[model samples]
Target: MSVELSVGKKVSVTVPGSSANLGPGFDTLGLAVGIYDTVEVEVIASGLEVEVFGEGQGELPLDGSHLVVKAIRSGLAAADVHAPGLRVVCHNNIPQSRGLGSSAAAAVAGVAAANGLAGFPLSDAQVVQLSSAFEGHPDNAGASVLGGAVVSWTEVPVDGRTEPQFKAVNIPVHSDIKALALVPSFHVSTEAVRRVLPTDITHLDARFNVSRCAVMTVALQQDPSLLWEGTRDRLHQPYRADVMPVTAEWVNRLRNRGYAAYLSGAGPTIMVLGTEDVAQSLLDEAREQGIRVLPLEVAGPVEVKVLK
Candidate 1:
């Protein structure tokens, strides 16, 4: 039997935004940046109520179909608990559909909120699993759940009828490393960008990406200098360039100047990971071309609090 949450019980959740692919790691690697979205969930006596502010104010749905609401219900089910009604308020700072993992962050905020309301019944791994299921891949979701950097993977059930298992392990990013995001004004659908990728690639390219993925893991932990080489890739990004010409142009521009820049997620946002800042003049030039520059530090895991 599900335990009923008390009316007036409230929980607040803060989850960070993330960047995935980080070049060669493809769907395997992700990093949580300082950008955040905060959601507050309160159990009430009657019907559901949701309020949105900041980033997704007018556009996002305010009903049960909302990703956050769905995730809350999923979390409550997993915890064997129920809320008679909920009041959810979201304060979003992450840019939507700009390769910044806004969707994953929302999912994390919802799951984390549910877990908090349930008196912390879910483990970190369970939280990761529930939140990641929303994305069909764990990279972005895992980073938001576990924070810092994460290496994640999925487990397929032998029966093929059961849901795939999502798992992630946190990685300690080198302290000196920072993230620089060059965000474009327009939104790009993750699905639309993914459709442009070819169905197959040569063994040589596969081998090349594997080596770079290995390099990236080491660079993120031990040697910041290896970042430039580690971020090199022959997969997804190349196929995506034509679709996001401005993002592609800026990525090439920053990389040519020796910064380790890559397309963030399924992007229109280009992300740079490095120990030092990119030159101001170049940043100014990107701004002149209408790109929004955000410099952020690596962030910690999602934080949740049961409110009085």
Candidate 2:
């Protein structure tokens, strides 16, 4: 059954950007950061409208084609409701295609707004599931919705014919641990990056990643210092190094200097797990090299506010 949604009521949502595959936890772990993207959605009369600011002003779609609008419509439909025209204003601080989960934030914000307009028909888990499905992966979606640190994985269904569904848990992190992102000016397509990876891996490589992932999980919970050794991986990064040589270069450089560094999601953005002071120094150096970087804290969950 669908709830009766009111017109003209305003809802706003704030979502945090996420860095996925934090070290060896490929396709499984994510960290929510301080970078944010906000969307204010309101029911309107005739047609959909959108205004984009900051990151993708001229690049993003001005109509229903926008990811935010698409997510709202999808959520509303899932709840068995028809969408009236919506007026959406977005202020995006997270850089798109920088492995910062900008797309995940946009999807979550839209779903949150739609849920509010529909009298809160969806739960947080449902919203996260929808958002993850929209992004075609769970790591970024899980972190954007649940915040802090997220671990996600999929299992096959009982019927056997259907695709596996993902489940996630939000875990606590040490307060001192933070993220430093080095985002280059160039854009790297996530799809393009994935295409370069091999279809299979050796048994030794699989064992190596699993052992490191276990260490990463525990290190994030209680001892971040262990991350210097725990973040080492043999699964995805080695095979796909050529896709983003600069990103790999920096990761190797930092590892040589005894720091935990990993590719933030696919490519072109490298994430360093360290304290603010240490991360800040790297950010400064990146800026000097004409590369942009942002030091971010592990953010709390997403927030929603209703306008009076």
Candidate 3:
């Protein structure tokens, strides 16, 4: 019998979905949600075996090309270990391509599981680095890695290098505050949505968002009741509205109905943040509009736990 360079074993990792830019944080703020992507990694006698369930259903590939597999491979390569023959099973509960940080969850799950399978050869930092590398952004990946809520920034590393450093601030996400997600029965590419954003932002608008972002983080930390007044944005959302007219219209409706509605990432899904009563009311309106509403309780804490 031939000996393998890397001994593969089964490991599981779960990552919560995240919503970035909650309102004014714009590529800085991210909140982990109740939704998750679970990944099980096990050794196989052959090449990579990828089986996907839930969200990506018919759309995902069962090959090394998938984001999860790619993250695992990247983790292995970074640790200078040979990529092992493995079987990957993914249960994706978060909606993909709907601005719910689906790719971030998948990437985080893969790296976390790979690190476990590799006998912890890679440190947590390495895993974050690997995930961030593949994801091309740290906001989502960092939030997934750290859990809870993260506000981060990308900085050019020394020697003309580029990398991102993130800090996770534990904010008191209100228990009474619920997330009412209004998801359309359609898919929109993140690239297409990004294309609609203006390259240059006005100084006044930038200042406005900066002020609101500060207010949002502090308000969520101290008094979440201020969330409605705090979660305001002057950047990105308005510019990207052309790509998500339905979401925009619905957000306006929610706001008019006295709820705080904001774009969830590069959204086709608008998140209505409010108390239970407002959430229920928003849900009812979503039903009336034929929009499926996923009511997720405000996520509490930043840490990944194995469900099984």
Candidate 4:
């Protein structure tokens, strides 16, 4: 049996943006950044309504087809609760399609909102699973749900008919670690960037990434100095350099100068993970080239509050 949420019920959810593939742990490591998106949802009497503000205000859909709305429906269904209607308002700070996990943040916010409206029926793991299913991978969604840094993986069902199970564990990030993103003006499609990767890779390259992934875990937890070596990869970044030349150039430049920089997700954004800020000259140079630089701290998990 389904329970109907009261018409006046309202909840507010704030979820942080994420940076995924944090170097060699491609599709496995993610970090939640300080940038956030906040969504307010209310159960109403009759129909669906949506309002988007800030980053994607004019371009994003204001209807049920919106990603946030879909996620809310998914969450409500999972909780066996129904809302007669919904009003969703999004105040977005995360840049859309900029490899900053804006979509993942939306999914997290919506699901979190639904859980709050339902008296918190879902567990943290359940929220991570539901949010990650929208992305087919747990990296971004997992970070937004669990916060700080996360190591995540997916389990495929043997029958291939059931949805893959998404799981993640929060890993403590060293206090000195900080993130700086050099965001390009143009948007890069994650799917398009992914399609460019080869169908297969050499075992030697795989081994290199595996070692770095391990190093990254250690570096994130205890040793910030190892960040340079930890962030090195022989897998995706090399191949992706061609399509995003400017981002490739900046990453190379920073790395050559002894900074740990890499492509952020399927990105035009080059992210630097280090204990201190990038040199001002480099930031100025990037700005002159129209790249927006954002200095961010590691963020906490998504937060939800019941307003009514």
Candidate 5:
């Protein structure tokens, strides 16, 4: 399909923040939460421009250096479509590098904006594939684009003729499950956390994680009662403790309290999956300990609102 973008067309896309790795799933499972970052784009007469508000106000770049614009350029280039001069506005809430899929949301917002302006040429899977190129992985971007809970994986074609492939599928999660994020004051860089991990692990350790992840998928759909056992991991978090001691500390603390807690994707945020009663007890304890946490339910599907 080929369609030219008119100079005056405008579009807005809202993408949700995601918490990935969900313990043993490791770069494959992600759950979209209520937090969001929105991008509003409009065709203009000249060069790119952006305005930012809320989170990342001073620290995030607002010019062509902005992540949103770069994503849009990437998407347009992938489509072999030329986008006209555009104005992009970002109203952000997802904290960058907080294990909340902020970068994925920005990447998707930009691509979605470009697709909308170009008269919607790319499919959602195509959008995810291009956005994943910017993210270096598909887990977070897949959840952001597909919404709800999802499993994403990469496949490198054995045949040299085809490029590497990304596949994402929405998964069913019982409604009784809820997620609470026990956030910290500081941010942990994804690279920093990854750098701290050991390159190898014992075979037994690998088996333990694989077992839990396998159970976790069925448990989330069939019965959430097993979450306490399902969210266990031995892969990265143990080694990453040195980078963010608080996250490691709380995982032990909350688990000891009988709550299923795990690092929220290279995080300083601990994701607690439980029922409402468990959530209440968590809040009570958090209040007493002076910890900050956000109660989040699974997010709805990603949306594009085009204003004609």
Candidate 6:
């Protein structure tokens, strides 16, 4: 493909919001949803400019300190392509500071937008790499770059810089499997969630999660009826419960009602996978338990799309 030239021009990229670390796949799994954050970038004359219109509206910055701008800079540096000036507009619908992979979406959108405005110089894999650099993890970045449900993980080095390694696998999901997210009013920082978790886990917990993770991965291939078997975990959830008591309570309530629920990322969000028959009841149970719910279907097929 010859370069699609656009000098002193504009381009845009819209990246979907994601939910990561479903149960046993802690720090390694992510599912992209329909909700998105759209970024528009234009080459200009002198400096960087950013505008945010949704989600974090007043709180999100417009300067170089902004996460989107930082990602655009990273992409430019990686591709060695610099514009005279940049005009950026972000239509952000993803919730921030809520374990919903909002930062990852913004980072991927920034990088992808920059790459497009720079004439599609970098490949999709390279775009993933650049976004991963800004966000520091590939789980969410992978899903943002490659849409739908993606199982991904990171490999960081002791020397500081790292490589984000991920493979996009499209799994066929059974119809009844709905991913219901209960986002609490409270916020839990990834750092704070990590702080509350034990640095080292017990061998029993390790073994238990390993077995369940394997089962979960296999279950994705076979049947949604087996979701409960796949969603059980003993490793991270128990230790990270302090920031997620709402998750535990709601999940337990769901299990009792015959639905499978798990912690979505390092959460304040609880995810329950269920059928249409009981989906409403699950939501009702969660609300009855005083937890707020946002019910959405899982994004399937696992294909990557770069919108410009």
Global lDDT scores for all candidate models: 0.95, 0.84, 0.75, 0.95, 0.84, 0.72
How well is each residue in 1-308 modelled by candidate 2, as lDDT tens digits?
Answer: 65545668788889999999987888899999999998898888668879999999999999878999989887887677765678999999999898899888899888877777776878877887777777677898889889899988766679988856656789999988988788888888888888887889889999998999899988899988798878888888886688788888889988887778898898678888976355456667778877787778999888888883
What count of clashes does model 3 give?
2
Task: In candidate 5, list every pair of residues with a backbone clash.
Answer: none
lDDT of 4 by residue, 1-308 (tens): 99999999999999999999988988999999999999999999989999999999999999988999999999999999999999999999999999999999999998999999999999999999999999899999999999999999999999979989999999999999999999999999999999889999999999999999999999999999999999999889999999999999999999999999999998988999999778999999999999999999999999999999
* Candidate 5 deviant stretches above 4 angstroms: 1-4, 158-163, 278-291
TM-score to true structure, per model? 0.99, 0.94, 0.89, 0.99, 0.93, 0.87
**What number of backbone clashes does candidate 5 have, counting pairs of residues 3 or more apart or in separate chains?**
0
Of candidates 6 and 1, the better by lDDT = 1
Residues 174-214 of candidate 6: C-alpha lDDT, one tens digit per residue: 55566667777777788878787767888988888788777
lDDT of 3 by residue, 79-158 (tens): 55564487889888999999888988888887887677656777655666677776566777777777667777666567
How far off is residue 17 in model 4, in Å? 0.4
**lDDT for residue 269 in candidate 5, whole number 0-100:** 85
Each prediction's RMSD over C-alphas, in Å, is 0.6, 1.8, 3.1, 0.7, 2.1, 3.5
Please tell me which model should have the higher lDDT, number 1 or number 3: 1
- C-alpha positional error of residue 73 in candidate 6 after TM-score superposition, expressed in Å: 1.3
How well does candidate 4 match the true structure, expressed as C-alpha RMSD?
Answer: 0.7
- The CA lDDT at 28 in model 2 is 94
The reply for model 2, stretches above 4 Å from the true place, is 1-4, 158-164, 279-282
Evaluation by TM-score, superior candidate among 2 and 3: 2
Which clashing pairs does model 3 show? 147-302, 148-302
lDDT of 2: 0.84
Query: Weakest 10 consecutive residues, lDDT, candidate 2?
Result: 275-284
